[model samples]
Target: MTIRTTHVGSLPRSQEVVDFIFARERGEDYDADGFDAAMARAVAETVRKQVEAGVDIVSDGETSKISYATYVKDRYTGFGGDSPRNAPADLKLFPSFLKRIADSGGTPQYARPMCIGEVRSKGQGELEKDISNLKTAMAEHGRQRGFMNAASPGVISLFLQNDYYRTREAYLAALADAMKAEYETIVASGLDLQLDCPDLALSRHMLFSELSDAEFVKIAASHVEALNHALSGIPAEKVRIHICWGNYEGPHVCDIPMAQMFDTLMSAKARYVLFETSNPRHGHEWTVFRDRKADIPDDKILVPGVVDTTTNFVEHPELIAQRLSRFAGIVGSDRVIAGSDCGFGTFAGFGAVDPDIAYAKLKAMAEGAAMLS
Candidate 1:
């Protein structure tokens, strides 16, 4: 069997699609139905490209969602108005730099959604187009296997910024229960469910920066509980639990380590674990397999990143192979899947890697994976 390769989620969007999405977010006048049609075409093309690039597994490029987590605001209930994105501690330490970037208008910001009422999915046909478009893309692409990524309950709380729930647990439970429908539908449709869960670590600094480690872990454990409850109906084998530190180019001083969350990650009802093991900050974390080998459940799969997405330089195929080989050496090739450190364009219109380079990186990853198979 070949060593499979896939990305975290969002790939870059076409300029036309980007314009329509940005216009919608800005409350500017745009044709809503037309925008959806354009997005569908984009998704179809993206899936086709993924196949052409030799990706063993593919995604919709998250064409319909604005950002991974914040898109939940429109699809779910209780979200209203805006919440300011509190500066992460790392950025706070570089206020002058942050000010310059903001002044330059180089950064695009999404208004954080506020939780004002109660949380429940609107059953609002949000995923209808997403699911249909992906399924259609599958048939057209002659897909091997694919996973559709969605924000986990914890990540929704992390990005949307809660304002109304009496306690964090209450908010998490409501969010989890509300998100259960999305999770169930994907699995029932025979697509792998990848739960984007940066809250387990990245949010410890980005969202809950003020909390102590012990305090932060209390929240993390609660997130795990809510996630398991959300996954109650789906078989673990079909689930992919994706966690990571912030994907941006940051100092990362405040980010938590992988060793800290291994137990909680292993406890999740997921057979595949996807996370960063290529970027400089967390790259060394591949050692976690060696340090905790016996602790990992035998059935679990490790989708360690073999390519770094935050940079524009295309990784040499041999370098990519080396990264994949490391993980395979430890976990055995059968359990290793090559992946990017994180999504190429994690947020809408917020691509760091050049669009063309992103596909090159993916192609290189596929070639690298072939080395092992």
Candidate 2:
């Protein structure tokens, strides 16, 4: 069987899209029709670019979102005020590096609304628009397979703090119930639903940094339970979960090992698991899978990132092939797919990889997948 290629959702947004998103975030009035038109064009262009780069599967580049985790604020009610920013423990240990990033205007500034009341969906208008835009673009390019990214309930709880819910478990349950509609909607549209669950991994060193690894694993298990509930109605084959440490370029020394949370991650209802394997910090963890092969469900497919997303360096196709081959050797080649470490654009205005170079890397990834095939 041939190897396949895809990427972590967010692609670099054009300046026009960025302006509109920020304006709405700031509560500034903007033309509704004009925003819709802009998003349509952006989605079409992004999908076209992915096809040209030889990617087998693609996304809408998450062009309409400010950021993956925070966009839920716009879709759900009961969120207001700002959540306090929690710096990653690894980044906090190096204040000078953090200062350099901030001084250079690299840190993204966007609204992080808190949960202040009972959670409820505003409507599915925005989600429907996203689905329409992606499907239209994919049709134009003759692409049959694509996935849409949605923020996981756990990640939503991590970014948008709970002020109204009495306890963390209560907050997670509320989130799971509220987000169920969106999860089912995507699957109903005949598209793969990708649950971006950074909270499964990234939160270990950010939100629950003070807890021991065992304690954090228990918390992660609770998160998985909530996620599974949200996915109850959908087929596991129609869903995939993405796990990653923070996307920023920093000392990721504090990231929890995959071994510690592997069991919890597998507990999600998603049959496919997408996670980082290309970045230096977590690159060596492939051995974790090799050592615990018996634990992975037979139905599960592994999408290991074959390209690094944080650097401008365009990895050679041969290096990418080697990375893919390593994972293929552990699991059968049919069980693996090539992906990127995180995302080219995590936030609208904030990204480390250049737009042009990001595409170049994806092109390289496609070439690498071809080598494996």
Candidate 3:
């Protein structure tokens, strides 16, 4: 098989591009139909770029969704007015976030349990239509394969609105049901589905911030069960689950090692697992593979990050090759596919690393795969 590469979820061409297009259309004060038409064109353009760049699996660029969590929140309905629309005080550096959102004309809304029937708004129910439209558009305008991104219920539920549910178990089960509609939508659309599940390992910080290590693990295990339950009927091979420690450019001191959560993650039903393995903070932990490969079933594929996403410096092809070789040495080359540590522009509003540099990194990734060949 030809060596393949894919992103975990959001790319640099994420909501930033959406917001940009939205601004341009609103500037003209275009009506709803005109606005959607402009947005659809923008999405197709971004997808074309990813496909042209040699990405084997292309995404809609997730231009429609804000963040993985926020997007899921928008589609469902349940909770109302639980708390003020403010960033957590502890996240001081993000103080201007709320103001920024307001400046962008975003409204503060209450979050809910994300259950079915409570709110029957079909956001992505048109997902198949969107994919079909993109396929036809791409075939006419460009050429490529496509995939859709869905949030894992475990990850979605773990990032909660305060006191939403009496018990975590109840919240998780509800999230699973609501998210199944999304999973089924993508599968039925006849496109490959990649589940964005950074919370599988990263939930410790977001969900269990107040708990002790032992307590957190106990809570996280239930989340694992919820994830497996949500994905119970999906064929593993058509699915790829992504797990990361969060995709921010920050001090990841609190990020837990996969060693601590590997068993829980592998238990989730996914034919392939996408994980962070590049970047100085995580690169050395490739040793985790040496220690844990025995537990990873042979039928499962491991798509390790060979390109670092936290910096602007382009990784040399040889370095990318070395990363691939390292993973191949342990996991078998046939089972390993190169990828990036995380999406380049996870936050649409903030511009840190230059977009041009992000493209350079993908170029390096493709070259690295070629070197391995």
Candidate 4:
């Protein structure tokens, strides 16, 4: 079988979408319906571009979102006001590096929303809008398979500061309950539902490294529990969970090893797992699959990233094939798919690879999968 291609969501926003997000962030009010129309157009264009890139499974490019995890604030109640967004512990460790990021204008200065009360769906018709937009694009472009991103219960916990819930675990449970219908709605469409869970691995160094191994495991386990509960009745096979450390080009010395987090990764009900591979920090960690092949259940599939997202270089098709082929050798061709290490545009208005370069990279991934097959 040919290695299949997919991507982490949040593809690069167009100049229009980028400007809208910035203006909205700056308290500039524009015509509401006009904004929606522009976003829909962007989603349509991005889907068409992905088809051209030869992606087997595509997304709506998360064009309507401000950021992947933080977009929840707009769709859910209880998140209001502002709070200090803590820099990742790793980033904080080097004050000099933080200065460099600020000086370089590499990172955007956006407000971090805080949860100020009990949780509830915003009832704003947001999720419906997203699904409708993606489905419409797929129909127009004659594509069949696609996925829409949802913030995992864990990732929501990771980025949003909680001020109302009495306990952290309670906050997570509320978030899970609030988001359960979203999972159901997406899966009900019968397209794949991608639960983006960066907290499992990224949080280890970002916020949880101060935790002992036992403490980290406890928190990680809670996250998995919330996710499984939310995914109840949704077939695990239709779900793919994506994990990655920070998408920034920062030192990842504090990243948790794949082996250390394998158990937690397995705990989610999702049957297909997508995670980083080609980026420099965790690129060499593929041996974890070779060593613990049995840890992967027979029914599960691994979409190990074969291309890097945070760089400008376009990977050779043969290189992507070699990476996918390595995973196939350890598991089997049927169990492997190819993807990027992380999203090229993890956050709106922030991207490492140029947008054109990002598509070129996916084109390489598709060509490589052909070579491997």
Candidate 5:
């Protein structure tokens, strides 16, 4: 398998459609078919562009969802009443310098569950239908080698703020069972599945601050267990788990060190570990691999970010090649896949760089891979 990787988080959207969905929440005038068609076109176009640029693996540009993780809350069966809310002031992960620069703009929120709703998980049938749509769109546009991204249960449970459950364990179990259905869908689709697990690291900043480090590790382990349970029959080769710090143009000083969470992460039943390794804050942290590699099983692959997503400047191909070479040297080229530090558009309404610039970055990455080869 090739080691190149790429991303197109959220494509440029017409202002009218954005307003209709966000401002009106799919009001009466909104046409679902038209919306789906537009999204499919955008996804196909983006994947086509990446494939042409030599991205070995591709995504549908995450075009259908408003926000990556928040989209699941709408599809999920549980949660009643309380809407998503902003992260508390103290828990805000961005540093003071960034806050001042961002003008203290309100960050995205998670939907709080006031009441436990029935497990409205996506079964095999729903999975087939959606996967069919994406695959068909790809085929129609002559695109190939694409994957789907699913939000991790930890992310869903944490961001949604399930305060209704009597115990944290019970809340996690409920979310685990519900999310398993979605996992099943991804497995059955026959396409590659990437679990979006930014929560594994970012949760330390957004969800739990009161707990000791030891306690936090325990909580993180449960998330891994749930994923392993859902992935029981699936071959690890078909699945990959992606972990990152918050994807924004902010100071990530509060981000958890990868070493602190490597144990729980390696325990996940996935063949590939997609992790943040680019960006100024996390770049040198690759040394964590020297100490933590013992915990990582040999069968697993490492897809380290070779380019930083929060910046608009294009990385020199030589720099991208060097990053890939370093990871390959540490873990072997066969086990390494070059990736981005985070998604280009983590938040729907906000973006640090233009979508076209994001593509140029991927193109640079592809060129670098060729140079290294």
Candidate 6:
């Protein structure tokens, strides 16, 4: 069987698009019509780039979002006031390295709004625009398979702190209910809905840093339950979930291993599980699948990343093939898809990989998948 290629959403945005995103994020006045035009052009070009590079499934590059999780503030009404920046645990351990990142302008600056009032959808106007843009672009490129990313309720709670809800559970439930519409709308538009849930792994060493691994897994399971509730009637095959230890170049020593949380991650209703496998910190985790192959549900498919995202070096095609083969050896090749460790451009202006090099890596990933096929 032929292997397929895809990526975690959020490719690098053009400068014109970045300017408009920042303006809107700052509440600064800008020509609404102009912003729309820029986004349309950007999405079209991004889709073209992916298709030309041999990605079977593509995305809008998350051009419409500020950052994956923080974009929720625009769609929902309860977020207000800034949430303090919480550095990852591993980064915190090395203050000098963290300072170097700050000095080098590597840290992305954007609003992290707190949930200060009741969570409610403002409407689907922005989401509809995103769908329309992606559909039009895909048609232009003659590409059929695509996925749209939405921040998971737990990730929303993780980044956008809750000030109004009495407990974390209440906050997550409200968010899940509020976000259910967006989740359904994406699938209804015929695009696979990707629930970005870095909260499943990233949060352990950041949000719940003080808790033991077992305790954090319990919290993660609750998060999965909330995600499952939001995913209620959505077809499992139409949905995928992305789990990652934060997407940055860091020590990542504090990250919880996949073995500790694999069962809880599989508990989500999504049929496709996308996660990091290329980065040095987590690349050895193929062993986790080898040991726990029995735990994966029969219907689940694995989208192990064959290329790293937070580095400039474009992975060689043969190396990528080797990476894919490891996962294919554990799960059948029929159940595997090629993907990236995370987004090339997670934020509008922030990414470690250069734009041209990112696409080069994607091209290599495609060649690698072809080798497996």
User: Against the unseen true structure, what C-alpha lDDT does each candidate score?
Assistant: 0.86, 0.92, 0.67, 0.86, 0.70, 0.94
Residue 195 of model 2: what lDDT? 93
Clashing residue pairs, candidate 2? none
TM-scores for candidates 1 onward, in order: 0.96, 0.99, 0.84, 0.97, 0.89, 0.99
Q: Give the alpha carbon lDDT tens digit for every residue of 7-33 in model 5.
A: 533444445445544643433467666
- Candidate 3 local lDDT, 203-273, one digit each (tens): 66665666776776677678767777877788888788788876654556666777877776687788788
RMSD of 3: 4.5
Question: CA lDDT of 225 in candidate 6?
Answer: 97
Sorted on lDDT, highest at the top, how do the candidates line up?
6, 2, 4, 1, 5, 3
lDDT of 6 by residue, 210-321 (tens): 9999999999999999999999999999999999999999999999999998999888999999999999999999999989999888899999998999889999999999
Model 2, 1-373: lDDT tens digits are 6799999899999999999999999899999999999999999999999999998889999999999999999999999999999989998999999899889998899999899999899999999999999999999998999999998989999999999999989999999999999999999998899999889889998999889999999999999999999999799999989999989889999999999979988888987789898889999999999999999999888998888889999999999999888878978999898999888989998899999999999999999989987
Give all candidate RMSDs, comma-separated.
Answer: 1.5, 0.8, 4.5, 1.3, 2.9, 0.7
- lDDT computed for candidate 3: 0.67
Select the stronger candidate by TM-score from 4 and 6. Answer: 6
The CA lDDT at 9 in model 3 is 54
lDDT for model 1, on a 0 to 1 scale?
A: 0.86
Candidate 6 or 1, higher TM-score: 6
Ranking by TM-score: 6, 2, 4, 1, 5, 3
In model 1, pairs of residues that clash are none
The candidate, 2 or 3, that scores higher on TM-score is 2
